[model samples]
Target chain A: MKRYMPLFVLPTLCAFILGFILPFIMGVGLSFCKFTTVTDAKFVGFSNYIKALQDTVFRHSFWYTALFTVVSLLVINVIAFALAMALTQKMRGTNIFRTIFFMPNLIGGIVLGYIWQLIFNGILAKYSTALALNEWYGFWGLIILVSWQQIGYMMIIYIAGLQAIPGDVLEAAQIDGATGWQRLWKVTVPMMMPSITICSFLSVTNGFKLFDQNLSLTAGEPGKMSEMMALNIYNTFYGRTGWEGVGQAKAVLFFILVVIIGVLQLRATRSKEVQQ
Target chain B: MKKKKVMPVLLAAAMTVGMFAGCGSNDAGTAGGSTQGAQGTQAADKSSGDGSVYYLNFKPEADEQWQILASEYTKETGVPVTVLTAASGEYEKTLKSEMAKTDAPTLFQVNGPVGLASWKDYCYDLSGADVTGQLTSEDFALKDGDQTLGIGYVIESYGIIYNKALLEKAGYTAADITNFASLKKVAEDITARKDELGFSAFTSAGMDGSSDWRFKTHLANLPIYYEYKADGIDNTDAIKGTYLDNYRQIWDLYINNATCDPKLLSTKTGDDAVAEFATEEAVFYQNGTWAYNDVKDLGDDNLGLLPIYIGVDGEENQGICTGTENYWCVNKNAAPEDIQATLDFMNWCVTSETGVNAMCKDMGFVIPFKSNLDSENVLVNAANDYLDAGKTPVTWNFTTMPSEEWKNGVGSALTAYAADQSDANWDAVKKAFVEGWATEAAAAK
Candidate 1:
């Protein structure tokens, strides 16, 4: 065990420090500094955080992201579960259909954004309006894009949960004269809680982390009406001069929000899981 | 039982330490590699040890030329050159990130005054070089006090480039568009039969990166041109914008009479509009001579450039949009050798006949150089004619500094007006324009 300890634990520790710990420390320090490069940072503490908290764009992004995540979370989980339930049943070419449905997730975010942009603009062309510069078009466009990309991935997870339920549970409910829907509600659903919990957690976290697609698709057109948290932080940091600290503050706030929401989601979902 | 239980915990502890050590090592390696690369860049020619030239290209159109130029320079000098071209519109942000590297490009472009100002602190000086003398004066030079930070490798001008064949085909000549009213009347007539002629009056007047040059700088010239003339001097940043109402006349005329759907203008660029003109779908495209390469293949004999006279008074004598572009400056941070090389290169480009001819051949450029700027190049010749005709040339007075706030602020306001043609939006545009200019001009550090 001692001999192999370095081999096994070394990679993860390195990953933590390199990917998370180091950058995190640097980022926190940067939130107080006003400068272009990290090394050249000039300490002007609290002002960056104050400005970040006060920014209308940052505040707007928080609300926008929250709304988007809630809406997408519900829609994605529902569609995924419905598809999972149907696919888990006896059916021909279920794997093929699953593969087909899940394929959208394989495409890169920037490419998906551009493809969706073309599709949206094509549809809007007949109406004599465009998706390129409008705000609502950007929001709905992101919604459609995210749902199309994530539903299949969540559906796969849901299928794993649905398949794990004991046949005896459903059989016992049937013997007790339960209707089909009743049996599903009493036996299958209760047993599928673990899968439902995990999928919900994943989709919710993913909604918070979203960036590339939002950037490529609309870039929050028509005065940033569709700007999300990640895009807002990026633009604030790089687009505005001397706003690095403010951008860093937004990032720290973002980290706190995601961590809180993620942990809360995990706890809530985990509590619903059946012992089995 | 105790030994067994403790095995995983012991293993995990060891793993954690190893992990941190491994990461620390990697960071040290990266930092070391960066330092070495920086040292190489600062070294002259042979000692650079895999040191190569990296260029972050803003013009996608110049990708081919850069590839050729880079390859030629490498073959000529035996210096390794790596050219990374930013697909158009990605230059500023990409360059910002790229410039922070330990192995930043030693030979990248310093395009304009605003661009120079943005990265002035990083440039190497080229002041006493032979290339410094090639310039007409300090007019095209960008300096940080005594240091010549950027040298114009090649300069360009923008105006209204027209399809003379289409004009002749429509029973008119390039000579006909002498005044604002004449230009407007002809454009409307041509646009009325856009189907028969298979063209329209103008291309998409979008306000994004490509097309905003038309609005923020070019089309706004009606107001600025008048302001420049009103004062009977050069470089007027102040404008009444009362004539901005007349600006709406030309703006409305261009937007309504254009071949493109205006709603898509937010995404359209000068490149897209020029593409339309090149394909002969639009009779007129507003852009700089930088666009000459894209259109030159259509045959220079058929292509004609008219001076921008959106609707200014005394418009008959107005010449093409007269301005300077793509100025070069040296880095204040460069080592003595690099500074010398940069100086040497600049002098070589301006004074050496080989350098000027090569620049002209590839760039089709108008140099500020007295000797070299005299070219068989008709575009440069025509630009000179505009200057010689005593027409007050409109410079890019707004770009005295590169402010993202000013660029996007002007763009945002112009975008709203382009959509609805509301006087309120125009007023908003003017407010954004004036206030943004005032703020940026004042805030420049």
Candidate 2:
């Protein structure tokens, strides 16, 4: 079994190289050139990256995306944990309620975005203004949308982690005369580190990578003040002239940021994992 | 603890499997190719009899007529004709991507100078061709010295389209207004009696891509006085601060005296503006000459279209905003046979009886051609009389080569103006207009 590790990893290795590594390499190489079509590209280095970094819109979008991700991570995890706590008990229709709550996650991001746009706008229309009228409306609108989409998924993870705790731990805590709050804060939560880590990682990464919903929801309206980082990178690459390399650089930076944060988080949470 | 780790890993594996399963096919690249069949694939697979013509038309109004011709061509020559129309204002972006495909539309529009530069690499010239004789003016030809890249199928005009009944109710006739003062006075009077007249002076002057042309092109033309003076002789660039103050005279009246709020109008969609104009809710529409056909169908004979007499120093010398509303340019990257087939179809449209008559009915008028349009085509003929009277038309500054970023930059500036009705915003528009031209000019370098 130990000797078959190479064979076991072969499929994933090939898929990763083909789908991610090759495209990334090609994208990086192409960033130095300027051409409408890939075959016709002409070398125009550093200029593209310089233009992108200097672009005021790209800078603004970076800040916007950072703010949105921080806010969304907090909201999604808190709600998911609460739901997971409620669902862990022996409740009626628990299975059905869990499935129902998870259904939104099954819907495609683009479809969900358009549907919510209709709902939000239909309500906002009475005021004779649109979601794009103000940046605050756009920010809160995206927060609500992302939270609604991701909460159930994180909840399921939290539930699984909660159930994995040993029954003896609770019994031992009761025998020690510990309160419910104290056990929840110490034993249960510390034991649940792995699940909390996974959920946090997903929510953070998803917040950073959000694209389709942002695109369909506002399309960076109110004069592009509400454009997020991913959408900003996309617009910069395609929308502006001589900015493709810069968008690519920004993407590279984004990858580094997410990786660093994810690694730090996993390290912090895994340190708290019990010796079970 | 072992179950906790194993179950989450299994779920992750399940999701990964599900994703790959959804995209099981190896050739996802080919999925983008199935649309608008290869430009000349039919021609290559078979003879000219089987050679299809794929025209990606920019003008939406010509769809019905093109449909008739496409069916007729297929019936007559056994070659299929597919005409695809872009939704209004999305033509440039559509053209760029559509031209990139392996089976992209064989025949696509390269309408003007901006289009000529952006698309010239992909455009095959039409110099000294049979279709060249069909144009009313050789001026419609978009060329880079010798490379005649595009020409007009139908030359359209633009100015003030108005409701004749609404004018009469305001105690005026078409004869009563021939210049800017009278037009402004009539608008003021009509606006004063808005409660009685059931409408205001002008329609909503939205500064979105849809209605900004009324300011950027038509109304802006009044100050330049149609002499093509914006950039001077051979200085092909957008109009800067040359006569921006003069442009403001009518623009102020347009937004302030209009029926709707400026901010509300800023947020209004194109459909709302067109609908309000069509329902006879307003007396005047600052639009192109192509509107005659749609306005006629509103079931009202009282609606009349004319050029605005907005104040110009030399008023009598000015006529309607006359030029090619759009142009037809063949794709240079196209297969030689398909390009020939497209040219054949184009020639047939201008020369053949059925094609000319069909275009006349569809486009609301016909261009000056050897085939000659039926005399009964009144809306277009009325527009032609303005050109025939020798009143110089608005020099469509469209022929000036703009950087590819020009349109988006202009759109952004115009959108800003719509949001905040301030002179500072107007100055930003001017800067974008001028600087954007210089930037694009530099890029094309």
Candidate 3:
């Protein structure tokens, strides 16, 4: 088995180098240059990073994305957990309810955004305003849209975690005069830490990396007040002329920020896991 | 046991090798197939060899006609002409990627001077070319120093398109409105009688992304044009916004007497406005000659254009805003033979009888070429009438707009203002127009 390891690993290693590592290295290099095309790049030191940091719009998007990530992470996880718990209980038609709840996750992000836009606009029309007219409206609109699309996906993960809990452990807790709430917190939750870690990591990263839904829903309208970091980076790269390097620099910073947050979240959640 | 272990190892090796072979064969198959297809086409007609034309067309509306024209050219000259039209609003991005390819576009388009700046390095000098000679005026040719970089192909005009019968029914005629004052009077009267008339004065001034360009860029051009006219300049680094107050009045009139509430305009699309004009729910729609196909079902006589009157001094002489953003540029990076072929093809497009008719009659373009044919488009004829009447056509200054971000900023501000219609909101629009422009202009530098 050890002798065949190199042969099996070679293909995946080559693919990773070609697809991810090479482009990532190139991206980091390009962030320090002024260029319209890669071939015409000229070294420009830290000017691009300076410009990216100095941009008020970019700073605003940073804070906006941070708040959005935190709120959406909490909302999606809580609702998903609740739904997972409910569906796991002994009940008829649980499969049907789960499938129905999970349907939105199957739809493309752009399609979901437009569908929700029509629905939201239809309801908001009675108030004589629209989702694109105000910043807060766009923010909350994105929250509702993302939650609607992502909650079911998280719910599936939570359900798997709930099902993986040993029945005997809960029975033991019940025989020991433990209440349902005590059993859930002391036994079920600590055992569910690994799944919680994965779920939180996914939700947080997804919240920060969101682009297509943000674009199709509002497109950072009402003076780009709702522009997230990814969309802002995209706009900087594509929308503005001569801002490609700054966009690349923003992307690098965004990558670092997400990594730090994800690592910290994983570490915090992993510590709470108890052995069965 | 050794034989069993060796059999599994061999199987694993075979599977891994098969995976690689699968990917390799797939790529090779597609590449070989494409080359074979190209060879098949080339073998069909072997004349006019070594100089195929590849035009990266900018306009999606004219794509089908361009394809027909390309095939026609190919049949006659036996030069393979490939026409690839970028999706609407994706031309710049497409052009950038395409230009980097080995077989880059031999022919492409630039919007105006601002568009030419980035592509200027790639543009072949059209000086002394037959196509440059065929241009109606030097103004239609975009030049940098001594070299002609691009030539304007089409001249489009936009104004207030009105329903002729509806105007007469409201006790008004095209001749009754000469300036902003009379236009305002007639529009206000129609609004006053809107309950009895069963139709509003103007179509909804939609602020959706699809519709907002009519206001943010085209409508915004009026103020920019007037400012330039006042400044006695063709281009400027910063705009003083001298005619913004007049801009305010025209915008206010459009929203106040429209088919829908001002607040509801944010969700209204271009199609909604066209539907309103087409169904006779509104009398006036703010659009251009390109809208002829959309509303021509109403008949030629029913369609008439009025120059957008934004209440300026001596403004009765203000003709429709007329200019071309579509300028054909030859790629300097292409092979010499391909360059000549592209040049010859362009000259033939404006010169040959089949080319002129296809462009004018079939495509509905008012091409700015000496050998251009008469267009049957009524809105185009109306625009020519204004020019013939000696009214000064407002040039398209929006082409000089610093960036798309500036346009989006203005559009967003305009959308917000339309929803609330407050003084503070209007101030924000002005700030977006003025400060946003300055910021973008500086950033572009």
User: What TM-score would each prediction reach against the true structure?
Assistant: 0.86, 0.79, 0.93
Candidate 3 runs further than 4 Å off: A1-14, B1-49
Best by TM-score: 3
Worst 10 residues of 1 chain B by lDDT: B33-42
Show pairs that collide, candidate 3: none
The TM-score each candidate achieves on chain A is 0.96, 0.92, 0.97
Error of 3 at A153 (Å): 0.5
Interface RMSD of 2: 6.2
Q: Which ten residues in a row have the lowest lDDT in candidate 2 chain A?
A: A236-245
Candidates' interface RMSDs, in order?
A: 4.2, 6.2, 2.6
Which should have the higher DockQ, number 1 or number 3? 3
In Å, residue A170's CA in model 2 sits off its true spot by 5.2
State the lDDT of candidate 3 residue by residue for A32-64, as single tens digits. 998765555779999999999999999999999
Candidate 1 C-alpha lDDT tens digits along B69-124: 55555565565544456545555655555566654545556556666655776777
